[model samples]
Target chain A: MFYRTSGQFKTSYTADMALFPVRQDAILLAIILAFAWVILPLTASEFAFQTLLIPILIYSLAAMGLNILTGYAGQLSLGTAAFMGVGAYACYKLVTIMPWMNPVVAILLSGVFSAGVGVAFGIPSLRIKGFYLAIATLAAQFFLVWLFEKWAWLYNYNASGAIQVPTLQMFGVTVAGPTASSHVQYYVVLGIVSLMTILCINLTRGTLGRTWKATRDMDIAAELIGINLMKSKLTAFAISSYIVGVSGALFVFMWRGAAEPNLFDIPLSFRILFIAIIGGLGSILGNYLGAILIVGLPVILNTLPETFGIPISSATVEHLNIMIVGALIVFFLIIEPHGLARLWALIREKLVIWPFPH
Target chain B: MDFLNSLLVQPFADMFAAPDFLMQVLWEGLVSGILYALIALGFVLIFRSSRIFNFAQGIMVVFAALTLVGFHEMGVPAWISVILSLGVMFVLAVSIERVVLRPLVGQPDIILFMATIGITLFLIGFGELIFGGENKIMITEELGIPTGEFIFEPFGGFLLLEQKDVTAVVVAAVLVIALLAFLNKTRMGRAIRALGDDHQAALSVGISLQTIWVLVWFIAGIIALVTGIAWGARAGVSFALEVIAYKALPVLMLGGLESITGAIIGGLMIGLFEKLFEIYWGQPLLGGNTETWFAFVLALFVLLFRPQGLFGERIIERV
Candidate 1:
């Protein structure tokens, strides 16, 4: 079999404990990166770049951030979009106040703001746990969105009460704002998402990740084992919100172009939650898979009827998309509660052992 | 110092200066509290019986009302539509238990919670597809609910109350009494409580999980219907009503997820206090519309003191 690792002998613990113990995973990732960095940019149409490539990357990053907290750390937060809004608004203010600052730098620094806010909100986690903590996060969700709406300065006192991303250039190439081409924007999102993914992989595999998993699996036992529950939980929140905030900055500045306070409402939070859960909560690769299914599925579904000449209205298609996504979530949970990542692992395991009963 | 005075003293001063307005605000809060209580009642029933936080409770309210309205639109009599809607709810309960909850048995709590959210989305799309997304008025008169005003003189000023609000209160009170009776007096009700207490113990005692789950869900459906009627009568039925479900979460937080009385009192406290705070302080000071997060902030503060909620069972962790 292509995935057979029988000949790949580990001579030492270091060799055995490498991130990619199997040779094939590295090869597969290289292929995907090639497609993302080279093939996709060259072949994809404007529509595909905008709808599929850009959104999937951004959503995957967002889901990865959420996965860090809920899936890894065990603290459930329903206020991800609000944190993202914090990132978006923070970035907006940064670029506006210091017009000379690099947009990319603003995006990275925006995460700092969201990380701070997230830690502030995460304090309640020390007091509460489970569904109670989740609901407490909603206080942040509602309150922050309210603040976004009421505080005019966040949107730069725009007449429409919405934040607009200004045109920005990097190396004499437009990278953001309405005038920017999808091609440049897609590359920016792609680069950030890839960087975040690598960061998440190492973070989740290291001490912080283990601490989060320990905290998530059982806080009391983790504490008994000498883990600082407060530090572990707050750090999880900070890291998770930082990544989510950057994705949010990218979400609005690169993809959305403009955003109203309503964009950061509960539905958006649920949508990101859907991506994280459906992607396979604890798995890194599941974020991309979940984002593909959640973000890419609707576009495909919308186009399928038209391609087949079904003559259905767009409204019906939209409704059907919602129903299908909802049903798919339930279906995925019932069939494989660990999510798409586990499903892939199962498939890979089978592939590794094909034609052998044992 | 001025900011602190406005924050603390001005609200009280405003209330004293306009006692009639204060009475009106309190009355409004009480009515909304009843509605919130009704919705929280649905959540409590489902959560207690099956340990699933039924996010669909809010949509079920809209779905039930829509079905009744849809039936009436189809030329069915109001009373017949009511009966028919109940039948639909029963079918929904049974189908959900059979299709969604059956295979999902023994799953993690988070998974089950997500499944209910799935149900919410399904119901939203399904409801909208059938009934269209436009807002529909509840046939308040056809349903034979009073729709008038009752004014009184209090604090040497005129205080106004809606007759519909009075009816909502009366109906909610009766429903609570009847529900309490059913839980205390009926065999099925006792079985539901048994399941809530311990599933394995209840199963060992010959209680049927599927039957009790369906029954609890059906009761939740019934409560949804009542709530839909009450709230719809106030502000027409629409998908927008679904946001009220979020309101009930803070109620569950403050009241305890499993405590019915907690839901009631918590609902009343939130509804009243949010209103009082909004009218006196929020509108003048914070630009109004504070109802969204007031309940949640209050609940979070309360949770800081009582992690298990106001009346939730005490948590005892074991290693």
Candidate 2:
């Protein structure tokens, strides 16, 4: 009843190609957006902001970047955190070197650096396909991470070998650094995520997106059909890296407020990949859903034992979280390889055809 | 230029200056090479049978080592602890085949790979919970493996080779010979190779997929045990040891996915070259710790020319 589409008729191509052809999806998105933009911040405690809201947004953006490459383009990458490291470092350099520039501009431009590096790494992908490409990307992960550690210049030669986000004001409000309030940081993250998501949605829905799908489904066939596999695959890498870089910037400046070299290690890459896979590959909305589940569930699990008066240690809780997440990954793959987004789509389909059997 | 000389010439000069140190590096490389070969064998065996990349092979090593040590700690004899660990790995193999691999049998290679990663995480957590997160010493003395070093004097230079490393080499050689013989002589091994060759054709011949899977995984489990013991003997048993599993990836890439010979040769080559580069070239010219990316970089460069890996079977994609 909630998703019935009987009365909705498309009169033209523009109407047929609408982002949310079903009115309910738009309304649902509006409600969610309003909550994210307004109600969550109003009701959320500092703990909620720091742990759940901020992380979910940043991770969603990061996963979206990965989803573009892995899910949409059909390339597998195990080195997302390394690309993210590229973004974070680039953003840090941009800010430190040009202190007079707008922080948001610096953050956005940082993605360009990552995009270039992403393309450089992606060059190998033209020849390396499938799991081979995935392993190849680890070269980037290990090398770039090593560079981050060895090159003191990237971290501004801090003896600590970590980047500390500096306080920066955007339109008279401190948007980053220790002095920045969570509310302001949350808004900043939200603004960037929402913008990138829109861009990602449009990109994935467009011709280039179709090209990626073609390459992903069967590269030889796609090439036979005159699709330049190189261009398609490289652009996917570029755009995906750009979005990932932006999220990396947000991850450090907006959320973490401090960063270390090992922060962008293999484990972080695996975590993002989990979000992408569990949320559903090749879906924009899936990134957000996946991030919420991957990020939020742990927080909820941590609190659940305490709330229930269980005497489980925090370390035990952390272990259980890892176990559950692992089990969930297998469960999700077995039950629905397309992930939560696909699950939601199935439910929506059933609702759209309510009171009848297909 | 001095830079060119440092990059090119000095490393060779340094190597000639200390033949004993060079020998020491080569010995270090060979031990790690054996371990890498063992891990790669585990990967090859499981991948051949089920088409799953078996990322859990790394954690299996950790889990097996932990279980052996854990059982010994619980007052079981060292030999009994080995049996108990084997039993644990058998149960693990069965559960993984049933729970994880069964449902994901027809999924894409990437999905299967991801599933293996999931298995890795779960094993890491489970092992940590049961064994605790602290590093445990390998029961070398309990197992009666000699820990003394053997010294050699050649051309007025001294070379030190640990007895355990020598034992590791001998044991690994025997294991590999036994494994190759088993594969060639056994009915089950033939089934695994047939499945790797053609899944449907093998199924048509009345070979039980589940049994083959379970058997293959169990074998991988056995290899994992040997790897755990050998690696733990050197580095101690801990979750941190899981990082070396990544080393096996480059080995697999360099060796080829389906070839056992590829695994062994690739493992040894990567091990030796990475060590040599780290000492001769990487440490002096580049900053130290080049071991972190050296294997992967070498593998990547090799893969650019041969995407199937140097020893990998040719990949023929069909639309």
- What is the DockQ for all candidates, taken in turn? 0.85, 0.81
lDDT per residue as tens, model 2, A233-260? 9999999999999999989999898899
| RMSD after Cα superposition, model 2 | 1.0
**Model 2 misplaced regions, further than 4 Å:** A355-358
CA lDDT, candidate 2, residue A85: 94
Give the worst 10-residue stretch by lDDT in candidate 1 chain B: B159-168
Give Cα distance to truth, residue A31, candidate 1, Å: 0.6
Candidate 1 segments exceeding 4 Å error: none
Model 1 chain A: ten consecutive residues of lowest lDDT: A348-357
Model 2 lDDT at residue A55: 96
Q: Per-residue lDDT tens digits of candidate 1, residues B31-119?
A: 99888989999999999888998989989999999999999999999999999999999999999999899999999889999999999
CA lDDT of B72 in candidate 1? 95
Question: What lDDT does model 1 reach?
Answer: 0.93
B226-276 in candidate 2: lDDT tens per residue? 999989999999999999999999999999888899999999999899999
